[model samples]
Target: MIAAGLGCRKGTSAETLLSALAAACAEANISRESVSVLATGEIKRHEPGMIELAERLHLPLHILDEAALKQVETRTRTVSKHSLAQTATPSLSEAAALAAAGEASELIVARLIADGATCALARSKDHS
Candidate 1:
C-alpha cells in the first residue's frame, strides 16, 4: 500500500493541506488516487483540515500513536525543530507514513513542507 502521511499546524486550511498533498505526490510521481490511505499522528486525528482532506479523498485516515511514530523516527530524512517541539517527533509526516505502511516500509518521499502543512509518502515492504 502507498500511504500519504500529513502534519499540519492547528487550524490549517483544507486548501493548504490539499496543495501540500498535491506537491508531495507530484514529487513522488504518484497520483493522489494511488494513495491507499492518509496517515497522521494520533494527536491530529481530530483536526478539522485533516478530517476534511481524508473525506475529500475518500480514503481511510490512519492515526499513529506516539510509540508507532517513534519507531520510525530514525528512518525519516527530514527533521524539523518546530515539529519536534510541537509533536514530540522529529518528522511526523515521515513517521506517520512509515508506521501506517507497516513493518519494513520505506519512505518513497521525504517530508515536503508547504504553507502550514507537511506531507510524505511511503510504500509497504511488500509493494514493488
Candidate 2:
C-alpha cells in the first residue's frame, strides 16, 4: 500500500493541496493514482481543504493522533522546526505517512514543500 501524508496551514485550499500533491508525487516518481490513501494529523481532521482533497480523490483519509505520529517520528528524514513546535514531530507529513501506512512502512519520499502545505510518501513493506 502507498500513502501520502499531508500537512497544511489553516484555510489552505484544495487547489493548493492538489498542486502540492502533484509536486510530491513527481518527487516520488509516481502518479497521484498510485497513492492508496491520504493521511494527516488528527488535529487537521477538521480542515475543509484537506477533507475536500481526500473526497475529490476518492481515497481513504487516515487521521493519526499525536501519539501515533510520535511513534514513528524518529523514522522520518526531514526535521521541520515548525512541525516539531506545533506537533512535537520532526515532520508531520513524513511521520503521518509512516504511521498510517502501517508499522512496517518505509518512507519513499521525504518532505516535499509546497505553498502552505507539505507532503511525503510511504510504502508498506508487507503491502498490507
Candidate 3:
C-alpha cells in the first residue's frame, strides 16, 4: 500500500462507498473472504443497507471513532509483484486508512470506485 489510497469527501452514500472498497480489494488481489472492515460511527449511524451488505460479503465489521482514524496508518507491506503504478491510488496508505476508518463519505468512495479501484474492509490493528 502507498499513502492515502482511500480518499473521499465527507458524507457519501453507503452503496457507493461499498463499491469503492470492493474495487480496491480487487485491485489488491485480496479476496473479500479474507479481510474485515472498520466503520466509523455507531451501527445505527450507518446507511440502512450497510450492515446487510457487509454480512453478504462475509466481512467482519468493526466500529471506530472517526477521530481515532486520523492516527492510523494505511500502508501495509509492499508486494514485490506490484509497483506504484499498479496500485488503486497514489496513496495506498491513505486509501487503506479510509477503507479502515471510513473517514470520507460514501460519495467519495463511490467516485474512486467509478475511477477504478479495489477497496477492502479494514480495521485498526491497534484494536486487540
Q: Candidate 2 lDDT, tens digit per residue, 8-126? A: 88999988888888998998789899999999998789999999999999988899999999999879999999998889999999999999899999999999989999999999999
**How do the residues 1-128 of candidate 3 rate in per-residue lDDT, one tens digit apiece?**
11113322234444655666667556655654444453433322454444555566665544434444333333333321221343333333343445554433221222133332223344433441
Q: Which runs of model 1 end up more than 4 angstroms from their true locations?
A: none
lDDT of 3 at 120: 32
* Backbone clashes in model 2, listed as residue pairs: none
Q: Could you estimate the TM-score for every candidate? A: 0.96, 0.96, 0.43
Against the hidden true structure, what lDDT does model 1 obtain? Answer: 0.92
Rank by TM-score (best first)? 2, 1, 3
For candidate 3, the lDDT comes to 0.40
Model 2: weakest 10-residue lDDT segment is 119-128
The Cα error of candidate 2 at residue 100, in Å, is 1.0
Each prediction's whole-model lDDT (CA)? 0.92, 0.92, 0.40
- For model 2, the superposed segments whose C-alpha errors exceed 4 Å read none
Off by over 4 Å in 3: 1-18, 41-44, 73-111, 115-128
lDDT order of candidates, top first: 2, 1, 3
lDDT of 3 at 101: 43
